[model samples]
Target: MTVLALGLNHGSAPLDLRGRFAVPLDALGERVQGLRQHLARAQPEVAILSTCNRTEVYVGLPALGASACPRHAMELAEPAIEWLAAQGGTAPAELRHHSYLRAGADAARHAFRVAAGLDSMVLGEPQILGQMKAAVREADSAGALGTTLHQMFQRSFAVAKEVRSRTEIGSHAVSLAAAAVRLAQQLFDDLPRRRVLFVGAGDMIDLVATHFAAQKPLQMTVANRSTERGRLLAERLGAAQLPLAELGQVLGQFDIVISCTASSLPLIGLGAVERALKARKRHPMLMLDLAVPRDIEPEVARLPDVYLYTVDDLAQQVQANGERRQAAVAHAEAIVSAGVKSFSQWLDQRASVPLILALQRQTETWRQAELAKARRALARGRDVDAVMDTLATALTRKLMHGALSELHGSAGEAHQQWADSLQRLFLRDTA
Candidate 1:
């Protein structure tokens, strides 16, 4: 089956639109299975990669017939867009404007580039590789990952590793965590004196906490609905856990706060931050909301002593380092190009599988016939050497007989083509 990749990303859509397309970790498998059902005729095998920067759907479909060679997998594309729109609870027309579709080698090439972090919001950021692996694992669990997708992802991962080891693609990288810390430094002269409170205990929160912890903040607390999960991350970071309910009450105690939670609504509002600022006697506070829906109210940024930054704000801070990583792009791209070529060659071999099997069966039949004749001759007391020689010559003649018959009947251009092919098959290097 040919491969197809379709969906929108940070480059093609805004964050608010992309957020609607985010698939929760718990629902990834079910979503993949649903997608497969949506395009069953196309032999849909699906894997979804959703992150802060993008949400892409990868599909595998049966190849077009010989008469339709070079045709796009547009049959799968329309139904897929409808299914994806429904899954995201968005209007099909709305998403289609920002969506994209890539077929055949282009789909595979896109995947390789993505896995190598060439398509990330932050150039060469490594986190997307882990996210992609998670998506692949989810799709496999749903029985939606078939041969084509399995091979594509496996090759994508290998290409990512090759690029990493062979070049400085990830060297001097700038991350969201680093961006948050850098912004915090701009407001506070000394991080050691600031009290920091981090909301949620997911990967993004963990990453941000690690960076902020490196500065050795005076007091750091992790707040979450589940104290058990919060404590696990807390103990590892040499920090303490706080009940999420206590966040509002203790907001005044922290000089800096960074939050990333999967809540449907804002965790901290303008009124709450205002109260905190009043409690602290107008002392400035640097706050960040890294979650998609946002953990802090947008109006909180309007407060005089409150510095609230969203994921978008942190992203802006990291773009300045893009030029440093651009030089290695060519090297990483060369590795990706070679990887695509290798994958294409492998795909071509897969297409030859049926023909190769038929050839093997034909040869076996001819072999069995020659063996029976040889056995009867020996049983009749004929010379063994003569029987063996006859068997060898007979088998060779039978094997070449089909090609010779076809060649003898061919004429003009067809005759010339068959003769050349026969010469190459039989004479090889001499041809």
Candidate 2:
């Protein structure tokens, strides 16, 4: 089977399209299971990696003839794309412009580069690697990871580590969490006096909390579906914890709210925010929705006193440190290129497994035949010891026959020179 990757990411698609393809964290396993079942009918292995920034499908399909490869790849990718679009309430054409399909070495290289954060909107963002790992884990739990995807992801992780160690890609890169904090600071001059409410206890929320906590806000609160999880994070930050149920009532109490939850639907609607705004007497509230599917409804942006920012809204702020990191891009690209070549070589070696196995089988067959013939000769008792010696010599000569012929047949300058040396050592003695 060949390696293939089909995905949509922040670079190619806007938040709306990306949101359509976002899979909730809780439902990821089930969604992957369904995808695997569908692909299993046509192909053997399939894995999915869905995050706030990207959603990718990696598959292993039989190597069809040249004329059929494209057709087969498109066929496999079509259903997946349709399924994703359906989830996002979009038409296939709506996503086509933003979708990318990569195969073979390109697919492998892209996966590696993505995990290394070279492909992110914000270069060297570390969150993507963890998100990719989480996707792989979900795919594995869904029984979707097979030899091809497993190797691809493993090499991806290795390349990411190599890039991180060898390059300054992440040196001055501003994290999304930090960028969010920076954006919030621009909206509010004094972060220390502003009340901050973080909704969700996931990694993104934790990161945002960490960055916000550094400012030592007037009041900090964590609201999550799981009250215990919220409390855990809140206690760590010396903040307060509130259940999701209490969010609406207490929403107005905070000046800033940073939310990133795995909800498939919008958790905070325009009406809710408007109500909160009215309660605050139209006081400006800075809201950053880091969730892919968006915890806050887009309409909330229209509210006068509500400043809502989606993942895309933060893109401009994230580019602030881009010029500083430009010098390191070349070094990072070099690292990625070298890593890609190594991964491609490994993939090529993997392709030769069947050929190597076939050669071994042929050698084993020849050995068994020679051994059986020797057994018969010894049974005849003409001379058992002589026959055993003959058998040993015959096997040795048979093994060398192909190598000796190739050495004599060599014509190329480099090949002929090596062949001449081998011939002098082995054939010269025989002659």
Please give the CA lDDT of all the candidate structures: 0.85, 0.82
Error of 2 at 319 (Å): 0.9
Candidate 1: residue 49 lDDT (0-100): 85
- Residue 326 displacement in candidate 1 (angstroms): 2.6
- Estimate TM-scores for all models: 0.84, 0.85
Task: Report the alpha-carbon TM-score of model 2 versus the true structure.
Answer: 0.85
Tens digits of lDDT, candidate 1, 118-190: 8876777888889899999999999999888899999999999988888887875677898889899899989
By summed lDDT, the worst window of 10 consecutive residues in model 2 runs over 62-71
lDDT of 1 at 360: 99
